[model samples]
Target chain A: MIQRSQLDLRKFVAPEFICGHGALQLAGRYARNFGMRHVLLVTDPGVRAAGWTDAVGESLTEAGISFTIFDAISVNPRSRQVMSGTEVYRAEECNGIVAVGGGSPMDCAKGIGIASSNMRDILAFEGVDRVPVPAPPLICIPTTAGSSADVSQFAIITDDVRKRKIAIISKTLVPDISLLDPEPLTTMSPELTVDTGMDALSHAIEAYVSNASSPMTDVHALEAIRLISSALPAAVREPHNLDLRFSTLLGSLHAGLAFSNASLGAVHAMAHSLGAACDLAHGRCNAMLLEHVIAANYEAAPDRYDQVGAILGAAEGGRGTPAENVAAFRRSLGVTETLAAVGVREDAIRTLARQAYADPCMVTNPRRLTCEDLERIYAYAL
Target chain B: MHMHSDPPDDRDALREKIIGLGETSLHKSYYPELQSRLAELERFRALLDQTHDAIFLIRADTGRLADVNASAVTYLGLSKEELLAMPFASLIAPHQKAAFLETVRKSNEVPSGSRRTCTAYLVSREGREIPMEITVRSVIFGDEQYIVAIARDITDRILTEEELKIKESALESSTNGILIADLTGAIMYANPGFASIFGYEQDGVFMGKNLEAFFATPSVGEEITGHLLDNHTIVKETIGLRSDGSSFHIQVSGSVVQNDAGEPLCIMLIVMDITERILTDQMKRKTYEQLGKNIEQFAIIGDHIRNPLQVIVGYVEMIDDPLAEKILEQSCRINEFVTQLDRGWVESANVRQFLRKHGDGGEPPLQTFIHIGATKEEDP
Candidate 1:
């Protein structure tokens, strides 16, 4: 029983974004509008191989702009790679950034922009609003439909030293523009498509029940939930369908707008810890831990969780509970990996629990979770 | 001004920021950086204006003024709008717009950071022209190319150079040997006269040689340097050693040149060759000695003549004949002549004393040569 009144103060921020088939091609035009002279094109090997990097490069070249391609990125962007990309940005005298990949490259591009503008190491900006100076112009062209890092004001970089992911949270991390083109989403493999689709579903669920959720965020969150629950299964079945891909892209964008404003809960906090500890995929970690976190946190915000359950429950022909419906949805999308199946051992749960307990994303959890409670949650996922 | 908060307080602040409530929390607007960058540019502009050199930013494509500094206004005696409206080349000497266009083209042909310098006269608003050394460099900011012209007034430098040339001519053609040496007695400069006197070419190895090498006694040069260091000036006659190992008299007058702080910088010595004067002095001394001996001989000869005359008078008294009387008279005459010879000797000795007192190097007395007034003994 959460009640909202018009008197309560709230704020919403979304980047200037364009959505359609040719949205990614308009990156160069938007970059020029932002006064970008030379740009650093950030992407991964997969995205570059899929021809997104070349297409964007052609667009920039046609617009009479210069760019340097830095494709040294992984599924989980490392602080080392972020700093390396920053080195390229400075060495080439690039004045702007264009990220053409999934969340890893986009998040890494955000990290690079922050580091280059602040003239410091990326790890120094680990806390919230720590960046006193904003990064240069950033344009994101997300290939996969997850992470929503293109629209979200969050950049997660793995600190290779501590073997964990550090979050740099600032409104400044929001990109200047997001080119939401679903054509690039057709090139994702079935597993990547499933994993990324699950990531979008987790974002909507966590944001809808978050303590920081507002009327504005709730509208985007519930709609995101309804869209993802209905489209994610069919999106995995027909990975090449533009309509299915566009639905997922639109759903991720809506969820990004929701969570970017409302923030996340124990699921993201625990997921960041698990992803960093196991060296696993971020989407997979979220997909594995999403149901477990929902079960543990169901008692804190029952009414909000009930609304979320109704959308997912309707998809499952009215299921048992919100947590059960989420599990069934993840399974239907063919994401059925347990924590141990992904190489997460039982002994590492306490350290993972302690780290998640301290994550900034944990601050918005509906229920305050202790280290012991998080350890039990990790155990349940295992 | 900045106090560190407690850890819990830090966490609280971070949470507030995570919820977008911190003082610095905002979306990526770039307003602050824009404000800071604009302020920095203003500071840089102020710095440019503070300099005495006139700075100009010209659009490379149009050869037109894009910007100008404060000094440019003061130099051209024109308002900012007036300067900006005119073609940049119109401000140059003779208003050669085509020439400046070519210069800009040449400057742009080189690499971005390289520059080229040329001398030009800047025609002012009052029609007065100022000589300037203009260094032009091509610069780029974003999409537009600009030419940065930094003009420095060279009037003072030109005048200084002309004055230096005149002084150098004087040193080159001087008749007196002028030598400049460091405090350590090493020769730094020697004028043409100095090189000629020392039997060395103007570009010879004598340069960088110690001043002691030119002194007959090396220690004489050292002593003079020490004296000049302590006393600041010295004028003494010393022996000089020529290249052929010959020594001659040299009159050297020297002084230490100091900077505005009154600290000694170098030694300047003016030397004159006095060997002929010394030789002439020795000859005059020898002649005076010989003249003194001749006068003494005259007195001795007078004594011998008188003695002989007296003996002849005695012989005449003994003879008692008329021949004897004649002989005695003749002897008396002779004795009187000897007395006159003695008087001549005394006069000659007085003349020698007078010559020693007033003669110029064995010449007769100045009054005797002029014959302005005869001496008391010589007057009739």
Candidate 2:
């Protein structure tokens, strides 16, 4: 939290959300109240196979709302996929959107909403606060405990031609309602659970040390770090434990409230660049790059980083610098690979660093990093 | 932690929104939007009510009136509540109600945008059936199917058509040869009277023929048309040629038919067969000439007898006998009779002039309405 003497100005925005068991069943009633008669149900093939899509569909049917399924989405959603989903949204004459899945489908749902309402290409909105018109009513039923896309005002879509991801940030991108039920998270594989939990931990740590951190954001960020570090390992060991899953879900929601307001740092910026260049999983990319970026930025805001480190528990009696402890925590979760092991070449570090330097998230980073500095960090992680 | 925070700088709208200070940074509440939508719907409803055509919305499944515009109330003379209570099919004419319902059922099965149009009479509150041209289409709103119908009144159009039919019958039944021709003297229409007088069958075969075909001299048709164009009317007795190439005297009275703007549209000619009148006039002329010659001879003979008798009386008077006195008396009597004969001849000339001036008091001379064209009457 900011000192009283240094406190200047800040704001926090959070969407209306409910987290509990059976929370996903309320989507139909909320959609009906929002006057959504016809809905475009956005999901991924994996979530559809997991039966979350069927469960949501049944709810919508019970409320007498007609919906069409749109599951043509990949892990990292492309602009073309968003455009195709928009076409389905229009062809079915849908009035609203209901996303049931992880971050990919939720972010794709946001792109589809704004693209359809504004009648423009999805990439036209690349930077912060570029959306001039609010999207149609979006009700998000999150099937994963991480990504935090359900509560955050951010939509990340990949530009196929450029081979880079663009972030569309606007307060209007926040969903009207989010149903955070832990039952859907049980279907996630152990690897997916660890990768997503590490992502939440990165989010909390980055938001806590960001230059834009305020008293309001610090409270949520530190609590998120504490909850994720304790609950993630047990949730992976017992995938059916509702209590562990709910703790991780709450942690992710709190981290979303923190980073969405305080913005992110070099970790997210570098992860976005690496994911775009290599077509790797977003959570794994963030998990691998988190400790390296913290080591680079620790000197700029050591006291804030120290608070995050103290609350963020380490694995196997880990002790050392805050960066070493975070690395040990990730390795304990079985993400024990360097950048080269994950297919990142040494010659591409310069280009990836340059791309990360241009990311909008760098504006709120605690340390102003140069392209060479980012390249050095990438080499050290490898 | 909030301690040791960096100072904010270079503020912009994007940065403001990132920190949630932008003007539109708020949660997604739909109350204001819903109110705006309802207001727009009210405006549209008002626009529909202002139209002259009666509009109705009927439930496709139940056939009941779901909604109605203000004009529907005015046209049907029923209260809004009463209209909403009844089925849409009951509002149509009794004979067409069954067929209308069938069409509505078919409309529900077709594509939503396609429309079916039919003519029917709308029964009003006073039991008066008014003719209407109705257009109906099926539409889906929410989960319900509805049929939207618009009805336009066609009472004035029907009355106008009936009036035109009566005028057409009058023209067909006229007795005079009423032939309406174009400006170029081409026959546009020749009624039955014209066909019969021209010795042709009334099958309208002569329709495209020129008016010059009926005149004994083709130039006469042109001259009559020119007169009508310049003076607007023509009345004259001219020789007519029939389909069999027979010539007869006929009187043609024609005028130019002008539009409201006074531009000549066509020429209408009323023709009369005056061949019998012409033949009678010719016989009358010959009889009058013969009678004048006989009167001249009779007067001459009377003068011849008077002169001889007077000469004989003068010779008898010189001898101074009784017979001389008697002969003078006889000359005086003969002179009186000769004077009477001269007076009778003068009266006979006056009678001939009177008969020539006036025709027999029947079938008065036909004159074109404008009466501007006239020509000399001849024997043949």
Candidate 3:
């Protein structure tokens, strides 16, 4: 929707990625290309329990890549976990890393690689371009349908003491290869499937309306919206349908590509603060706040939102506002929840608003937001 | 009431359905995986404790001391348990605590993995202030954010640096011109004295210039280079050319600077302008030569006058007349005067002395008879 003359200079970056029913099988081959004799395998206990970690590990063993499993990572991966993983990597003499799980494991793996190579505390690499060197050879096999950390130049780690999530953005954070296998989605619960599907939807919308969005990113962003809107419901209803799961996985991958290049808007900014403070699921927070952020930014990027509405099957030739269309879509997925229901309190709105306004994602938000505006949004969501 | 009655009978069936969904969502057992990772976590703690620099882990939000390593306990002069129980500010010097806190705040505000350095002082248990260069970075461990500060004591380094600065200042302000040139004769450094000697007001004007350019001729440059190449210190008088194309005599003492391995690194040339000293030496030589010639000439003149006067004295003494005695006395007096001049005693007034000795009067009229141009007669 942005005119050619109005387009600014931009750059795009993404990891080499493969997506299919069994793309997880390629993790070993990619690790071998990096000449990894021994690798540190990063995953959360949840992913390990789901048996995806074993599948990836078996492939590594088949390829003769010996590995040490580091399954201490948690949701919203902590810096301590990253440091602990780095210790394991150094102790085991791992030359490479293979992350198996969702965004949390991938991000934790990136943190481990950075810490191992730089030999510094993981907290030192928090902002854009803060990483001075590339992480060790990393291959990500994402089991979740959302949180495209495998291909993104971003690693969101929770600062437990500060009760916040720190965004570490650098090109070095992007994995060497992202092997996304949709087959893993069949094991996810219906709640997780719905949550991640909405997360993918929010990524597409936010990327499309972001101030940094370019023509290259817009194509992927709009296509992601169409794919997610058409496939998320079916995938949620029938988790074992490989075709529906693969469609959602591809949609999430495209959305990741879009946002990784164009960045995201206030939806991510607010969700990061809310999720960090309240310890909620990242995807659910994004889903709950997407419509409100779109409503606030609709006037600033109306045409961009109109296209998003059209992709989501809004009536009246997509002439209706993006907020209404997104809200309707979210309701269709049975995700009607207020901020209060998600553990956000009226008293904590001020702190959450201040932190959200300070998030790095706020730089790419379509509309300028202040702490007051964010507080009002939080209040409205509640 | 009628609508609710229809659904009441299916409560038991609904519970079973809910239980089945819960069973399906439950994840597999993770206890075995958690047990193995706990050992790795212990290894991580040991690794942190072994670092040489005193390391402190403080909570990013509260500035509480979460952990301290063995080195920190030794450096702070406190036990590990005591150090861990204290606040982060307790280790910082009172005046530096504010700056330390501010640096911690900035480290927290920045993204994880970004490091900031601050030079601050820490208070040891003995109440001594130890200067430390601390590097602070935010790290998340477990579920909490912490600032990992690595502090290194820099007291010795600071003292060494201060001493080096003083020595450097002395060399820069030396009076004798100094130049350091590479093996190929390209000048690398020229102190102020070296610049001023070459009529350059700025020292930088001499940098990167060939040292041979400052010599009066190529041959002089070659002679100095040969001596340096032989690893010998050579001190010689030579001519040096200034920037204005004028040459002056200079005394140069040069030696080759070598590394610990005895390989030549550079040539150091110490030069002093000795033109004035050379001119003074030349003048002294000319004056001495001229004085020697004048003494020789005076001897010849004395021989010629004294020989004739001696003959006159001998002839006048043999004739016993009063006038003959007068002539002998005057001749003897002239001979004495010639003797004085031959002895280089021209400052003595021998004519006045002779007149005063022989004249029959209280005060002889020596002024009336001894008249010379610009020479006033002395009082007798």
Candidate 4:
């Protein structure tokens, strides 16, 4: 490991972003500036029913940009949906894309753009730097506070044939513009709010303690942890409060920018397998798995974990470690669900362990993990 | 610890709760909006049909044509109804139909919007074979899967490409030195003939060199550029410098090449080595001039000798002595020999034939006597 003073090289990448109460209205204007004559507007049915999709469409029409709707994307978006979206994009002659939902719609949009531009199946692009071309101009208006697909360089797409979520990481997948508006966050249920908020917390903590972390990512990760710790409970309790929603949105955005450059650790790697195999909410999986990963990795980076513990309101030099403090925080949010509680079978632990061990995120984990070690961790989580 | 075993009653309660949640979450029904937003798509049909390339939509499951554009109808030489009723495989050549169907199957298996291109021959209604480039894309519309093919005739394009290849081959094999240089005199291309003429083993060694480097003087390149700028194509003989720094006579014919916009792009120069021809011409001219001078000198010498000989002959005849008569006879014979020498020299006659006609077949020959200015040593 290079000491901070001896570190000589670092690179950071982030998308052009805006965060405010009604920045979602700027999606169409940004699309026009990107030279979009016609666009494919990707969203899920839930976001469509929440009225954000219609609002985004009105903005596009007012800006004199024609668009087509592709709302067939589902949670844990399948590769088939991405291909179908690409077909619609070509049929409509869309010059750009506007995604108006959570991670599923945005990831589906990214997959569509990648497949269309590269002229290959979406599954062909898995892992880092595999996408050969930049996606068409994409403007994202994220409705959920977590899963910052609006500004992230990551696209998690599920391969229905393989029954696993493949993470495609490339700077080209970063949206051309991100329009974050807290108005849409009011529609999320309290359970969803807690789950997604905890996902953001996992993103911050894991990025801060990752082997690839640097000073540039450290600041954003810590700031995200501070904001999520302070504002997530309030936002979950009072869903309609715009201020708390904005804070959580900013926190998620910072966490995304941090992990995008610094990368994540075992928490994300393990959560991906669980999310894909069980078809569960991704944030809930990450929340359930974050504390255990930290417990396993705290010995490798004690100072960074201690800082995270302090941010979560643990006393300085306290008897409890940061991993315990984070667990306490998860309990306070009422998200203490075990793997068995979520209907995961003990027989599947070995398979999930092997998949998580092979995930790309495992490479950046602070402590090296073997397949056996991952299986043990899964048992511990159970 | 004598505790009574309690039955696991919570399993049924938990199962009921999960089933309730799953029922509420899993139920989905499609509701089509009554809005008239997607009506703009009707224009796509006309646009697709208006294209020059043939477009056909085939059902993936049946491998039959579901729809075809006007261009497809015209290209296939069949009516729209007939074309749509025919199987897509019937239009493909019999030998290529299997491969085409396999490609269509693979396209169906791949994700929608993935495309594949193939070069195949399409059989027309009259059994005429037309080479075609076909692009097939998988599409899903209204719950049905289709393979849309756009085919273009590539006969003219292939012919043009072949013609270009022939021309390029001819240029490469030409014996005359050929060079193409930019306006700034930098050599862009040099053929093998140019390399050999310039004493290089390969054309690549001469590329990017200045055109002036191959000229005996830099001013020659400038003069050629000046003529080219005036749109004057010229052929001129000039000195050429070889790679070894030896100079030789060369004939250069140069013209300016231009683009469709009428802007000059480069200068094309054809060079021919004319050193041997120039040397032969110079030798012939020198021989002719020397023969003329020799004839003029011979005439002058003959006139001077005859004038003196006549004076001597006249004086000897006046004296009327035997020896003096002999002298007069000999002088007359000498004068005859000199006159014969002048008259016998014909430009067209072979020297050996002239010798045989004039010389004796003995120790002393007639041509030898003429050279000594004596016919006989004189009966005196």
The CA lDDT at A250 in model 2 is 96
How does model 4 score on DockQ?
0.01
Candidate achieving the largest TM-score: 2
Candidate 4: which stretches are off by over 4 Å? A1-6, A314-319, B1-380
**lDDT of candidate 2 over B31-64, digit per residue (tens):** 4487469769989989998998999999988889
**Candidate 2, superposed: residue stretches over 4 Å from native:** A1-6, A314-316, B1-28, B35-380
Better of 3 and 4 by TM-score: 4
Error of 1 at B132 (Å): 25
* Stretch of 10 with least lDDT, candidate 1 chain A: A1-10
Models sorted by TM-score, best on top: 2, 1, 4, 3
Query: Tens digits of per-residue lDDT for model 3 on A110-213?
Result: 99999998999888998888999778778898887889888889899998678899999999888877887888888999888888888888888888888898
- Tell how far residue A197 is off in model 1, in angstroms: 1.0
Task: Flag regions of model 3 displaced more than 4 Å.
Answer: A1-7, A314-320, B1-380
Q: What is the TM-score of chain A alone in each candidate?
A: 0.98, 0.98, 0.96, 0.97
DockQ of each: 0.03, 0.06, 0.01, 0.01
TM-score (all chains, Cα) for each model: 0.56, 0.57, 0.51, 0.53
Residue A168 CA error for candidate 1 (Å)?
1.2
Question: What is candidate 2's TM-score against the reference?
Answer: 0.57
DockQ of 1: 0.03
Model 4 lDDT tens row, A1-382:
2234427477788887777876888776777666678989999999999999999999999889999999999899999999999999999998789999998999999999999989899999999999887787888998898888887889999999999989999999988778888999999989889878988888889888888888889999999999999899889888999999999999999999889888898999999999999999998999888888888887888888988998886422344678788888888889888999999888999999999998999998988988988888888888
lDDT of each: 0.86, 0.86, 0.83, 0.84
